[model samples]
Target: MTYKLGLTGSIGMGKSTTARMFRDMGFPVWDADEAVHRLYASGGAAVAPIAAMFPTALDNGGIDRKALKLALANDPEAIERLEAVVHPLVAKDRENFLQKHSDSPLAVLDIPLLFEKGSEWQFDGVAVVSTDADTQRNRVLSRPGMTEKHFEMIHARQMPDAEKRARADWIIPTDTLESARAAVERICNEIVTDA
Candidate 1:
């Protein structure tokens, strides 16, 4: 049987980078964010339903993320409504990914909201990438158009880093690239050994 591992972290915690490291080490990785991006693109499964739900959020050919964000901000129930339209499509995409990688000894599903969505039970194990608050804040602030309010808003929606770490089967501290890479290697080695 294949080992399915779920990888997650709060914003600016190097989750994507660590996922790439897993890919580099030969694990097939399915990225939830990428799946959503594809789903929201023109001719994608999510486009028509999302357009029906929020017509103003559709651009020339695809879903306008900024407009969607504005809609969510304006309506207290908008996120739940939006998820109702999009979550099933994302779930289907993940299912397809799992089917494609079924033969692999181990595979990773990179879901930013795995814990928040209560989908961690689907994985054999879960890994969280973490860093100090200062580093995380600084990294997020360095991104274009990132502000304190935006950071706080994102943070409010996610589980705290401490809580995430506590729940993680493997905790990777990504204070530096070298350390993060070492941790990834170690985790891969351990998983291989266990399997």
Candidate 2:
């Protein structure tokens, strides 16, 4: 069976880049964020229910993520409600991914909230990318619409980088593209050999 590799990192920690490296290295990746976006754009499966909960976020064709952000901003309970609707959809999609890729020698689940969502149980092993705090802060703060206050709020919701580093079965410190890809290749080779 394919190894179910779980990959995660904090915001601005190069998760998208790492996920690309994994894909380049030929591992099938199930991206949870993409799944969420899919659900958002998909039929009335979950979006309508979510719209019922937060009406301002849905319109013409799909959910307006920015509008949803505005509605949920500063409202902790609003986030909980959003998660209640979206998480299940993501979960079912993840299960579908696993089932579809069951025969591959290695598969990856690119889950941003893997730890926060208690999703470790679904993986053969977890790899977390880490970088220095200053690097992370600068990288995140450079993004459009990313305020320090919002960064802090998101960080507060996530497991600390240090703690995530400590908990990971494999740690990839992504300071550069080449080095990060090397680490991903190493992990892939290791998993393929071991499996």
Candidate 3:
């Protein structure tokens, strides 16, 4: 049977980088963030439902992410409405990805909000990538248009990294690139030997 691993981390914690490393190690991966981008980009099936909910935030059958962000800022239900339209589509895509790699010994689902969304039920095990809070804050602030308030707001929506670590099967720390890579490689080693 294929082993499904759920990988997650708070924003700017090198989750994407770790996911890439897993791919380099020859594991198939399903990235939820990329799935969301696809749903917002050209030819996305999510554009219609989204446009219907917030007509002004779409153009030519695609979502204007900046506009959507502004629209959802103060509106409590806008995010809920948006997630309602997007999650099902992403879930379907994820299911397809899993089926395609069912023969593999292991596959990874790189979901930033796996625990927040209670998505771990579908996985065989979970891993969390982590960094010190200051490092996380600095990394996030370095991004264009990311303000401290915005970072705080995003953090508010996520489970605390400490709490997440408590729940992780393995915690991979990304203080240095080489060390992070080694930490993840070590986890892969554990996975192979655990059985």
Candidate 4:
């Protein structure tokens, strides 16, 4: 049986990089962000429903994230409505991915909001990628078009890094790339060996 490992982290904490490391080590990874991206793309399952819900969010036959953000800007409940439309589709996509990779010894599910969404229970184990607050702040601030206010907004919505670490089955600290890679290697080996 394949062991489903949920990987998560706040923005700029190196969750994506760690997920890639797992992939490089031959682990099948289902990325929720990528799933969402595909769902919002043209010809995706979410496009039609989202279009019906927020017609102004479509751009060139796809759901435009910026437009969607704008649509949600004024209404406090808009995000909840959008989530209602997209969440189930994303869950189905994740289920299909798991079925497709069922032969694997282990698989990784990279979810940015794993804890917030109450998804931690679905995984056999959860790994939280983390970094020092200063490092996280620096990394996020360095991103193009990212501002302090935007970072604060996003951070406020996510569980604190310390709390995530406390709840994690494995804490993957990503202070440096080398350290992060080693953690990935170690975790992969441990999982494979135990399986």
Instruction: Pick the TM-score winner.
Output: 4
Q: How many backbone clashes does candidate 2 have?
A: 0
Clashing pairs in 1: none
Q: What is the C-alpha lDDT profile of model 1 across 55-155, one tens digit per residue?
A: 88899789999898887788898789888878888888888888988888889999999899899999999999999999999999999999999999999
lDDT assessment of candidate 2: 0.88
Better of 2 and 4 by lDDT: 4
TM-score of 4: 0.97
Ranking by lDDT: 4, 1, 3, 2
TM-score of 1: 0.95
TM-score of 3: 0.92
| Candidate 2 lDDT for residue 125 | 98
The global Cα lDDT (0 to 1) of model 1 is 0.91
Q: In angstroms, how far off is 110's CA in candidate 2? A: 1.0
Candidate 1 or 4, higher TM-score? Answer: 4
Q: Per-residue lDDT for 1-195 in model 3, tens only?
A: 778899999999999999999999998989998888888876887888888888888976789988888889869888988888899999998888999998887889999889998878888999999999999999999999999999999999999999999999988899988988998798788886774
What's the TM-score of each model vs. the native? 0.95, 0.92, 0.92, 0.97
Q: Rank the candidates by TM-score, best first.
A: 4, 1, 3, 2
Residue 79's lDDT in candidate 3 = 90
- For each of the candidates, give the backbone clash count: 0, 0, 0, 0
Model 3 gets an lDDT of: 0.90
Root-mean-square deviation (CA) per prediction: 1.2, 1.7, 1.6, 0.9
